[model samples]
Target: MKNQNIKVRKHYLLKMAFLALPFTFAACDTEDMLNPVPETSISDKNAFDTPERIIGQVNGLYDAMKDGQYYGGRIVVYNEIRGEEWINRLTNGVTGLQTWQQNVQSGTNEVQNLWGAAYAAINRINVFLQGLEDNKAKIDPTLYTQYQAEAKFLRAVAYHSLVTLYAKPYNADNGASPGLPLRLQAETTTANNDLARSTVAKVYEQILKDLNDAEAGLPLTYGSAVLNTTRAHKNTAIAMKTRVYLHMGNYAKVVSEAQKIVSGTTSFTAPTGVAHALQADVALPFTNYTTTESVFSMPMSDLDAPGTQNQLGYYFNAAPVGNGEYYLNAAGIVNDAQWPATDARKVNFIVTASGNKYLKKFSKPSPFTDYVPVIRYSEVLLNYAEAAARTNDMPKAIALVSAVRKRSDAAYVFPATSFATQQALVDAILKERRIELLGEGFRAMDITRTLQTFPEKTGSGLNAPAVAPSSTDYVWPMPNSELATNKAL
Candidate 1:
């Protein structure tokens, strides 16, 4: 009887999910790309009727991405805590205690909520894409193409996030595992909720297809630093492609896609679009989101905050500023001797309070309006270096890794015997990723893609067991909401 009641509740919630519209979209002003005017209602009939409405719809897509359950904060926190980097201090269920312990079930709040939010965003994108096609005559041809590209880029990001959490890593059986439902059509009703999961390879195929299409249609640059940082431009798609290809263990494809933006070996920079290069100071990008180094980040402002509970600061910061739900695990990456105390990445981001260390990358107090980084030029460089290492391009790999490391710790140098072989160089680059992307959410993805064990750790009297690749907890289960409605699941 309890199970039947739960199913009924899930089915009803799934139906309601289709009807939840995005926040009111506002037209961009001459000075700002996302000055959203809240509290306005937008009907489907008028969603793409004018240029302003079309622009608003595109902005709406980003707004969806920044939802508390997705990139805004929870996804980032979930990804990090699932790895061995952090210890659950508060053990707050509302945050991610289950995820920290590697015991998340199908009925877990994050499991169900994140899945629902991602598909909601995807469905919204599908609806917007369909609307654009249906009303093509109303918008400029160039604008129409750009908007479609943006939608596809967003859809690709959403699908990628879903797959990473719910399915096996691409390296696992080369993506032979069961994946997401791959919903590409606009879903305004629950009539078509009986879709089956696609193979992981098929989902990745769709992701690459979207990215390739996005790269072709997206503009070279948005002209505004804010726009370039926040919006999907040609380089943005190319950078994302490198990440996707790397996840698939396709080093050749990663190098190919990375070359579109990245140039030179000794000193890497994006030759054409936006002139992306490593920030002289690694902390510069964090201080200001609209920098050349930030390839793409989700924008945040006081008007559109990523909720109190969802703020990254709220998770990793201490009292008077944040709740300090999770703190750096003593046995984690902070213990690495390679990551010296003088390293800017460490000095600037890590804070010690109550005899515990916390990551302060998202340091905005209270409301925590820090722009969540989605991808950065530094990550692109590391991605290139890793792929180059795997492909035996040792010189290029060493140069790229050195460039990234020296940007943060100017005087630091790699050991003489570190690059003795390709694997050694790759190992150093991977360690750099752990330091460079500490709290920015690359931990679990890096772990799973490399097929490493989720290392055991203890905090707050809770011991998280190590999860091997064969463990059922290696990947999250299909959410109960999905199972209740999708008979094909």
Candidate 2:
């Protein structure tokens, strides 16, 4: 069954490839790839008349989301380049340690690939939403709402990620902060090429609105076993809200959302009949796709699949069978020791050999496995801790932190003398996040957002040497292709 899904995904990718070429050639300038369609010819009379058709269209959006160009490849590349983990393999011979801080004029494939892929997903989501609306009455109203909510969530997520990486952080005091171009409709013609950037706050407002609508419409849980882990549920919506709130520095909202999941008081329930817990046998959580820990994951299958497979382990692990892109060294291991020795979460998740520690989060030997997680349960606990500490609920914060720590048999108690203030506690939580969530495509966002909240770092080691926005190193420049086409940057 999983193999069938892989084949379907490959077929969808082929269709997208063929569909994208005309647009790709038409634009000439790659940056115009994300322009919104002023008018879509797709009408409500013909789409979603059958269950099979609607399902296929929805599946296409998921396939686009998993494209190596998007989450599978360049998105991870952007995350790694900005973070402390694996340095650019191409820059190894270069002298400067700050090679990642290069200007957008560098025109690296990594940058172009990321920009193109994000727009591609946005385009796909736009098409799906248009189809669903056109055939609203022809489809089951419940399924129609669910599919629309899902596409909206995906679109909002893609846009949010693009704005964060492509533009500056949102400043409430400054209404002029540049944000990514807002592309809400599906473009099918050449006239939609002209586009302009929106403000950061405006972009975030759209993201929040989509999430709110999705939470209200999505089911508490998926009805089918095959769909539960693979599809977004009410809890997934809540989990994403927690993350978005955290980035926005809304501690009260973060705490409210996270606590709902952490205590199992809300719509979220651990996958029934799955007794999966944080395993004590290994240092890191196993990359098992069926685990209860996953809030949502893209399902992959087939050892010879066509699309991007689970190559995270293959790329990061030490030599022999693995590609030695960023082999762990002594310094890497020492920096990673932030994970306590007794924490089994650290052992199985990271491979320590030859004095280097390789990330083993997705250790499956097969090359063709689906591997993208938008959110996970472990992140929920961390969110609760950070938000509680920020809100002056030290006891609640410590308890949440300890719940995760105790799972791995690591030290669950924080000394009362360790942090005298809420700010200090927040620092500890951030450090824990860096080590725990490394290589999961979050370090860069965390770094940028943290610097925004705590400008002063006299005591907090996390911010002692901060990366400033004005510094070329803080943000990746607009891709040269994008700059050339839009000319707005």
| Best-matching candidate per lDDT | 1
Task: Enumerate residue pairs that collide in model 2.
Answer: 44-134, 282-344, 283-344, 283-345, 283-346, 283-347, 283-348, 284-345, 284-349, 300-370
List RMSD in Å for every model shown.
Answer: 5.0, 8.9
What is residue 42's positional error in candidate 1, in angstroms?
Answer: 11
lDDT of 1: 0.87
Clashes of each: 0, 10
lDDT tens digits, residues 380-446, model 2?
A: 7788789889889987877666666666655545556546688778877777776666666786787
Cα lDDT tens digits, model 1, 437-487, are 988889999999999999999987999999999999999999887787678
Q: After best superposition, candidate 1 residue 321: deviation in angstroms? A: 2.2
